[model samples]
Target chain A: MLFFEGSEKKIEVVLQPGQPSLRQLEREYWQQVVAKANATILSSVHNEECDAYLLSESSLFVWEDRFLMLTCGTTTLMDAVVSFLEQFPADSLAMLSYQRKNEYQSHLQKSSFEQDVTALQQQIEGVGYQLGYLDGHHNYIYHLDRPYQPREDDATLELLMYHINGDTAQYLRSDNQTLEGIRQRLNWEALLPGFLLDDFLFEPFGYSMNAIKGDRYATMHITPQENSSYVSFETNLEGEAAALVLNALLKTLQPDSYDLISFNQQLQLDHQPGIICVDQATQPLSCGYTMRFSHYLKPPSAERSADRLSL
Target chain B: MLFFEGSEKKIEVVLQPGQPSLRQLEREYWQQVVAKANATILSSVHNEECDAYLLSESSLFVWEDRFLMLTCGTTTLMDAVVSFLEQFPADSLAMLSYQRKNEYQSHLQKSSFEQDVTALQQQIEGVGYQLGYLDGHHNYIYHLDRPYQPREDDATLELLMYHINGDTAQYLRSDNQTLEGIRQRLNWEALLPGFLLDDFLFEPFGYSMNAIKGDRYATMHITPQENSSYVSFETNLEGEAAALVLNALLKTLQPDSYDLISFNQQLQLDHQPGIICVDQATQPLSCGYTMRFSHYLKPPSAERSADRLSL
Candidate 1:
């Protein structure tokens, strides 16, 4: 059972447009922080004033004001988070959402081997972290202080990660299919229309592409190693286009199996996303693509007001 | 994406029970050969005269006079194969159906860093080898010499491998349920009655179990690491009972999505086992387990007589 992680640790930092470092010198400071984590910025793009950096492990997106940083493998993201805050003391940090898949914990701990999560938990003071499987698919998620403003009308964006069939890896390693041919077959450009996309391929076996339109952007990274193979599709847009993007991504990846992990920041307290398995989703819907299971990661309750105040 | 291989080099040696070193002192000599492959016999069985050794990565089954050995990981299984032939020079070697998943090739090359498969291929004289994907899942299988006897009424047995959904991994690693509880809930005893099963739990993570009922047997291996999680169900039995055992195993595993890789060694030219996917199998069938894809590997035809005679 091969499973791929979209990101080992994803930190969502939201800030108002007025912050001094938000617009100026953001790249220089954050690049150093990325270096601190021993990861390389393979490629980057600028759409209007916003930018996206496709890192060796994960991804980083910068809007006009907000910034999203995600890292996989052995990147010391927690330590980098400490560096980011120090370099750019926010006028006011609205919310910080930090999440990591359970398997990548070993990678993170490679450098910080002497210290476990308890010590990292101490590093994350006021912000409370919940560590457990999210969306009920063995993928673990960790959230920090007031990760999202739960809203009645919020239709949260979803990040889908597919464990592509081993054929992708075999193709990458072999010269059977050119990268352009693959992109065309997958409808990569059509999926994320209207953008000058930046794409890159790792020397050994990996593929990545990122694009941005105004402040809304999408990016995909594929690790094609037999031991670590996964195709990740992510976007920050909403409404009808978002659903289209998810479906397009699925069709493009053509994963033998996939797990859809969505963190709905704003779900109505009473609304429940019905649990859908692989069989149910494949019936009337698209090809073999199926939803494994879907559920809120324990909806934030009004009874937890005290918990929010602690932050 | 993570894919697991339970074999690097598998040697299927069929010898008559009258050989010089057929049964007694068989283990002492073979243990040295296994040691050369850098694997240990984790747990095994001694049913009267038959024996089965579950290796660290693969398996070895010795029933009556038929010896089957398979190795995965960075084990030098090819080198061990040569030593095996030297140690037990059989009066007449009926057949050798050696196979390996593609990923394990790199592991075999690790020990004899300077030499490659071409060298080993040359060394394996009198035995023609064919390398390609078996049952079409990107798992390369190598066959040594003539493997099967094609017949008019040959109803060959097939052992299938599926990539289960990730939830099974979470369940295995969970502290929510104990192993005993899981066994009871799975109806473990009913699946294989009348056998003293030997089971072992790999500390901090994995689980494995093997049982021998006379000459017939069943074994399960679970590598529950979140990144590389899979539950493989394999049994060498046939008929309606085999189908029942498969359903029972699927229910016990309850994988969200799985791919069935089967290799039916012998079969009547006109007999075709239906390809059962997620929809057809899971309809009235028990549990939430669903199949991904099933297909017959293009069988080697009688037209390839020259290829057969090349050996």
Candidate 2:
């Protein structure tokens, strides 16, 4: 199978006062935005708080005052962002932040961080900051400097995982795997509790899901092929809820390493057993948000040595 | 320019008794070995202790009891190892090791580590190991077991750097760059001291060099493109001297991150001022060698924040 870039490009925008609720916007409008990014809306779900899209490449979520859209593969997310801006009055934009995670195969990307920044600058001026090392797990962020208010409860945690292992991973690659099978294996009832979930399984391989409850949301995208296997879990859940889900999923997937990015100090991950935080950085953005990036790695097991002997 | 896989595939084999010193093997014999790996020999140099060849893709070094050959790009170094084994009796193999660094573009590689291990298994039984996280900076090693003697003084250090920056990186990419200029830029006088150096500059932009002193050897290869830029410094030198060279090169190249692998505990690096060791592991290999792998990252600087603002 051809390698897929599971790392995503994300944009979150908070609208100014008097603007229509983003959830009121028609699905056709959102579909155009997704199309501009060169992706499609496979399906979607909504609750009182948000409209969540299960995208062909990744996902999108919309709230009354804000909206988030993320796409993977070689989709031109900057193009989508630019097209999105054209639909709204420039004065209606209270805040705009664009982010991209460093890819395992950056050469396959359609645009570099610099190129994206250049594209974003054409519509709105923003400062770009890089968190962590350029050679390793890092994030590129461009934040537009519009007036904005920070919500006490506004927070987001994104966990991007790589090289997943174990029976769960094997099952993910198996022909018999199903969305319900994965939900059972992951035990979403315990991990996500009351949150509602919407998910899809792709032909040959791959999976994507969106879950919503009140104003809280959680989404997951899994690319389980060997060599380039990856899984990303993201949530707007706060504190212990976020950490609990993080631990539970990690226990199930057992990725060799993962990069965690938190916005607004929502997640304070306590030390995880068997996993060590390898690299971390906290940067306050010009866009009025504090961002923290941490990379965690599981210790190489002694069993790997024994397994190598059998090989 | 297309991205080059700067990470290397390496093999080192020790010969049994009554065998010809690898250094005494004719240049044509080494040429065939390089050819088998699908790389061309660019130049060569020798000292009393070793013979080193600068290849189109990387470098090779030959010593009396053992020889180390490393080639980058998509070259299949395992094929060379298999061919080299044919020239000698199976009993003449004292020990063998084949290693591959996790590549930025693994899908572009001719073979996976598993495939290479399978190929090697056709010749000899060897224990395979994965050092460090498979998703991050890591190494795969397959070591063939045979009668072997471990020497207290036998040690090797390899520093693989990525995403290098600063004037040195720019100069290396510039048309004005020359071998002598790089020598002065890196300050080999302080780094290698008594070592005799031989080097070459590739067309467009790239570099390869070899250095030797008595029974010790060092080799360097540079791929100085933007997205996939990489440089590797390796030496059989011991202790503090090795650390000194490592620090000096880091100062000049200013790579954002680097992976250091030491075999037989040849180097004990003290704390570096601006860099942090993000990951570290020590493994005792079945091939009578202890290997230590450490990944270091320079902290994101305040200056980077300011630089982003200017952009």
Candidate 3:
């Protein structure tokens, strides 16, 4: 169960005309939430408005009255949301999506479904949708009406997750030399021209990552564990998806297989023949947010053959 | 609205101990079913036992009474299935999967579900699944429990499809000289190495392809129609998962994003961190068949911005 959660949750609190400093609210929330907040400023604006912090698991973002937090692994995220809301009024908006691997235990199943549901539902009248296939659940998405949902047609969020298998995953898990090879393959500074990145590798399990980019941050988290390794390329900004960046990421990740999710304000995929995209649901959720989950698949038996060969 | 239908409908008619030749049955079915049937032999050992045929928007296969047929576009498939069952006794197996873009109309909506269901139910006992999202429907998969499902653990089949965008599509669509450039980029004869490939391009809206490497094919179908084009790479061989082909396909297809589905006789993905595979359902369908799907997506907003910039 080496699956890492890629789901996201946002908390948007509207402070009255001249309410308490957002900086004060953001600071208090982090100090109370993150266990080891060896917070390093990756990059940010002058007033720390569009700021990003790399914590134990992933990140914390603070921009004006809006604070967006995302963390994977077994991080105590829901409680952090509940705690921070004590200062803000019940009118605050929230959009939470917590997704993990088929093998990983869900935070929702950890007896927090009703509790967190109560917490967010108590604040805004929005509900949550538990999405996944019959074999196992993929993630949980929760969003409120007003401030949390995108008002503009341009603001779109897309996350691409890759599960590297065969030689690519094996090479990365070989040793330090492989890590160096991957690092050289990336050449991040040259490939991702403008952004300042913070890079590191996790011990024992060999998880290599870069919690990066300028104020409008993007990240590359690679769990380079043998047989169970994964690489995730995520960005919230429109421009982060430059041509070179996309090419460089694909070459580096070299996953045996992958899946795509498009959370657009209202955009739908242009038509293409010969390529089959299995759409999960393109309609808006009960709460008015819309997203499309489409996938191209490798025939199912390949994994079993690989397993037999491995044994 | 660019989507392709890769779903397949395999009609397996089990004959008696001394029934008519499966070859004759296969040919009779084809001439009466698929139009024109511009038959070309890719590969097979001695007899046309394990063969693959390309029709006008459809394909036919005959492997010792385990006949499998697949069709995309506005194909009269179910009617074809019904006509052939006349000569043979009951107890046939059917596995049908035909899916398209969100904007494309579902063949099922045209009142074909009951016709096909009745056609199959008239002979054998099986069911179907309507898989896709709100923007458009995708595929229809059907199968029977007794004869078609593999008892051997080694059996597996997989297909990889990509909705290619960016320069790859542009270069291929530019002109004949650019087609030469793309051909050089592909270097199929050199890259594919083994069997001879049959390559061709369609008129009006260009469709370039290569179907090679014996009966176990490695086909590349490129519909280079700007903003509405796709490139599909499909293979069923176990060793085809080799890294070279994967790299070559990515380099040639150069898709902005893509997804994959692996259909296994009994394969479940090895666990990975961070990646959450939304299982449609883990338990074997009533037919005792199983498959796994994975994806790699570009965040949605980027596409919109790209669309706007193009404007």
Candidate 4:
């Protein structure tokens, strides 16, 4: 199978008070926006507080006053961001943040992080910083420089796992795998808990899901290709709830390395026997939110047969 | 120290029969060409058969009727190629070959391999092929498709080593190291016996050298940074002569992994006790030249403390 760029481009924006509620926008309109990035909205689900789209590439979430859209592959995410920005007045965006994680094969990408930031700067003023090392698991973050107060409840946690191991990863690559089988394998009842869920199993090998409960949302995307397996779990859940989910996934996936990124949340990962922190950075974003990034890896000395997959 | 982009871009071309000899070109002219790529020609050495230039970024060698230029860093080697192509008559080129190895940090580069191929195609018609997996160590090759015969002696071998280890690596990285000290550390008298060598040692860390014996040439470039230590050895010698040099360097460097690329040469690498071939590919180009690429690694199970450096 051809290698897919599993790393994602993310854009999150909180609209000004006078702006129209993004949730009022129709599904067709959102589809058009997704299409700009060369991706189609496969399906979507809604709850009282949000609409979650399962895209051909990744996912999109829209709330009353804020929205988050994420995409992978060679999708021109900047095109979608530029299109969305053009629809509203420049001043309509109260707080905006753009983030990109380093990809496995960056040469296949159409635009670099610098190019994306350049495109975003044309529409709005922002500050950009790179966290971690360029040659390793790192991230590029850009946020609006204007002063704006963030909601106390606004928080997000992202867990990106790489080189997944064990029977679950093998099961994911095997044939005869069903959506229900994957759900049971993931044990969402224990991990996600009390949430309306929607997910899809891609042909060949891959998986994606979106869940919503009350005003909080969570999404997961899994790429099980042997050479570059990656799984990303993201949520607005906070504190112990988020930590429990993260720990459960770690136990199930058994990734060789993983990165944890949190926005407006102070996340503390307890020391695991074999796992070690490789690098980390904490930055106060200009958009009135604090961002923390940490990369942890199972050292080769502690490696098991399953965790020794070559990258 | 900043992580220098160790991967290189290489271009080789043969001029038509009636064209002016490139050797007649003055150092000032070649300096201008190198300048276009944002690199300075540090020093140069010349034998009766060729003029070898040790560039700040990489190396360049000019022969009577042909020339080869290889550059690293974020240098725009395409700009230099375009400038050189513009100087000659469109039909004055008999054969041209351009090759680029997959870089460790391609996002930091100014142009992709495809972009370079497009730029080359603008000057002359050619065929291109990718030799290995994009997510792994690979090479992109483009050569003129026009009818032309290669010299019986025209052969090149490239040994690209990664994650070098042991005393040599530590010595290279240590402060207060001098050119004579590095030369002795590399044991040029043993590795490159009977050859006249010109070498340079970078201020903080790094080493480069050019050697010539009669008409044949060999060059070595080393980047000794902790995160991405790399050493490349290339020569125009054939068969056992090339293999001997390759084995000697491999013994000294003790790289965790390496790639062997040869043009117009059939290289046979004897199995070492712990090293194994992970992936390989062989392709015949339209220019009537055969190319072979092989990637070898010392698996983690056999890893020594020296070979266990994190990539």
Candidate 5:
């Protein structure tokens, strides 16, 4: 037997010699205390581990399986396994360490295996096959049924000359060796319809027209006396298409005029002289009988102010 | 009479009205033909009433002498005369024609003749005065001594400033305001003296120096062991004079190892162990050495290959 003293009173307590005390028994106790404590600790640790797993699961899914195997040498694998064990409860220390070692080994084997599979899949597809699939399945198709046709043979050349002028035909055919080659050479300026200058349609009588082969329209050399001449249309088009289009275009563009006398009379007026008349009943004519006889003058205001000579 | 027959050797002569016969003889022929023909046509025209001299002499001179009783005008006198002529040369001709008629009646007596004589003489002398003459004497003195002494009050702002700066008394009184103002306002980066920093002088120890304004130099926070410091000359006159006159100035600039340590200590170097030297022999001895070491060690070569690392 052994005797123990209390702190507040000198009370004696008896115990078996060499036996464990009640305080030591609390530490050694394994019935419900040890198990309950372990369960609480493990549940909290497991919850934390679950939270970390949810947070990083997508990242792990993307790279963990492949990257882990790449860095899995002896020391690196050991470090991963140890980190895995540290996330488990201390109560389940043995089982968690064993499970972590197995997981590390499995990751290494799976990463190595996937590399071989990926290479095999690439070989099976081959180059250019995917590109052909994309082109056939998903591109637009443009079909030009009436392709541009050009004349290379003598007969075709003759037909072209019959439609266009001889000069135009000569220009088109001089550079091209084949019918397709001549067709490719058709420029925007050379493609105008032949009806533009056809004499039977738009005959230039009072007015004159000059035809130029290239892009720009020919210039006209109309004198001030010939200003009464105008562009006339003979088309069968209707409504605004006939008058509005022609008038609007005429308003913007000017008919070119040059001095024919300066050009040594190479250009000439095709029409008769433009005439202007004055009546005898005007203010100046009423002042004198002699003014009434002056109506036949070529220039009416010749005797008036010098400024009046402009007209 | 002389006569000749058709069948025989005979001759006949008949007189005609306007014929030169021997009866219209020697004295009359010499007077009409020889003497008149011998006279020069120019001298005969000069003797005539309608002489070329009537047109050649300026009508202006004739009118002034006959009507105004004045001599030819001077340059100032001509100004008003020319202005009148410019408006009316024909009117001036008419006036001169009237004057010519008056000159023919020069003997006419007049009551105001003395007064007219005095006025004409005075006008003539007035004209002579502007022509640089006085009485009968020529005044050699012409333009004033100082033709134009422009007033200082009329000077432009820039010219005033130039005058102020040029005057030594004004410059010293203002302590060279113009130079100081210009230096402060100008963009000195473009105009800074070349080779100035490179030539900063180091004193006795032969250490290198780099001089810069306090505003231009960057503040560097360095550890005590790695302090890199410089001595600054702060006086305005010293700085300006140094910039203007110094040559091979680096010889006077001194930067020692001791200065660097003191600067680093002031920057709290003890807190930054990484910057301090741990090993004696391998440690950098100077600021330049430390800078080179830092540059070499930076970012620690990412490439695994030794050849790429060297690059």
Candidate 6:
């Protein structure tokens, strides 16, 4: 029988073939397994306990001087648990001793809530997210109805990729193996750009995860400027406007085809109107026309009569 | 014989194509020539004169405008006079008012010797060429040597090379036609190191005739740290020691020849010797050899002393 820990509670065990009941199994055998698993969790949690707090109930539990907590879950839940355990292990509990009890609890609650909010926000904001406020405050509080859809494989890959070096290509070429082997040859600078160099840390390409297929070719799409205006409306209003224009342009043009879009005061051609894109290039757009508006006119005699009546 | 002005006195002449008497030339012709030359000299003197003083030629004579005279060697004197006259037209003397003085002997005797000494002192100290001192107090001093240097044909082009754009390649590529042409082709950033952007004002390349040249290519002999203990005598001794060792190593190996000198310490090989010869790379040397020094051992006595000192 195996027990799994979930976000809120412990999962009930469903006995498997050849597995003994709790009474039949030797106490020492279970104790040893629990101790070994706890040690593993402790070691992993050393530096990153803040990120690993969720894993506390999943990998091990506190029982007297020691703790034993382990459970099973859906593959997605398992991956999340594993990742959390990996980043923040049981050993991280030592670091917690230095933190004030109230402060630590508050910090843990705030971070956990933030993680949940971020996950929810990202899901709700997909494609087209409304830009409005419920009250006077500028709070972009996301609607909780659209729960975050976690991709287990992507989550796992992202976790692994975070630790993988950028120059893993060299090792991959040498070994001709996929996954773990490539991960073992990580350089801290290549794996974590910002950690090594302050300038590269915030760059779009710095935190990108390479997509891998089982027994197939790996593909990587670098978001060189991932936070560009087109990706999210949550960015600056000017950026949002720019993104809107780009999205419209991308929709109008077919991929792998090239065309020059000239914009003037009036549409020169009938087929497709060229949109006026913002100037991101070094050179100013030539033949650009400024849009002008005028109010409808009335007769000079009627205007004079209206002015005289007002006076 | 053409009359050419020498440094001290004007050379008067009559072009006879044979031996001619010095006094054979008509007084009016001599006066005409003298008037024309004197007008040019006076104009040049005004342009060159930064300041002036009113002084009596003698107690018998009323106080009038007096030129603070400059003395020069014959060759320099001729060059100065020629340069001054060449700047203006030949018949410029008719524009100025002239008066003849009857008491030449008395006027010459009353000339201020003290004023001449003061002018010479100011010239030496880089001052007082334009204005004379009144009652031994300093006044406006014109820089005479400043305007003396002759401008070359490519003077503006040279200035554009060393300044405006500072692109040596562009300056070389542009046909020595016009200043604007050179400016259009320049890529200033490529020529100068990014750190030295402010120091660009002080042109390292000699653009002006008086500009000094720096030692662009020099073999700086550096002693190895192990052989020389005195090398570490400076404050921040650790940093100095490392720089000396690295500089020596760079010079010996000439790593710059292969363009491998730009690799940061973390990417560099340990077995590779210390000496590296860099060409234009003037990045301040860093403490790269600290890790390498760990492999080497200090003498036993020195180690013991270090331990004792620590206690």
Instruction: Compute the lDDT of residue B1 as modeled in candidate 1.
Output: 22
DockQ values per model: 0.03, 0.16, 0.02, 0.09, 0.01, 0.00
Minimum summed lDDT over a 10-residue window in model 5 chain B is located at B154-163
Task: State, as a TM-score between 0 and 1, how close model 2 is to the true structure.
Answer: 0.67
Best-fitting candidate, scored by DockQ = 2
Rank candidates by TM-score, best first.
Answer: 2, 4, 1, 3, 6, 5
Off by over 4 Å in 4: A270-273, A301-311, B1-6, B9-43, B46-51, B55-57, B60-69, B73-311
Model 6 residue A231 CA deviation in Å? 19
lDDT of 1 at A5: 38
| Candidate 2 lDDT tens digits, B103-195 | 865656778787888988888888877676545677878888654666888888999998788899999989898888988998888889888
TM-score of chain A of 1: 0.70
lDDT by residue for model 1 over B133-232, one digit each (tens)?
1101223233333333422321223333333333444567675656675566445687777755666666565566666677666666675544335555
TM-score, prediction 3: 0.43
Where does candidate 6 stray beyond 4 Å?
A1-212, A215-217, A223-311, B1-251, B256-311
Q: Model 1 over residues A41-101: C-alpha lDDT tens digits?
A: 8778886768788888777887655677777666777777767766544435555555554
For candidate 6, the TM-score is 0.13
> Per-model i-RMS in Å?
25.3, 6.6, 15.2, 11.6, 55.4, 39.6
For model 5, the superposed segments whose C-alpha errors exceed 4 Å read A1-258, A261-268, A271-304, A307-311, B1-49, B52-311
Which candidate would rank higher by lDDT, 1 or 2?
A: 2
TM-score leader: 2
Residue-level lDDT of model 6, residues A171-243, one tens digit each, is: 3323244434433333323333222111111111221112111211111111111111010000001223323
Q: Per-residue CA lDDT of candidate 6, range B4-68, in tens? A: 11111111111112323323434343233333323211111011211211111100000011111
lDDT of 4 at B121: 74
Q: For model 2, state the Cα shift of residue B310 in Å.
A: 19
**True-vs-predicted CA distance for residue B98, candidate 2, Å:** 0.6
User: What is residue B44's positional error in candidate 2, in angstroms?
Assistant: 1.1
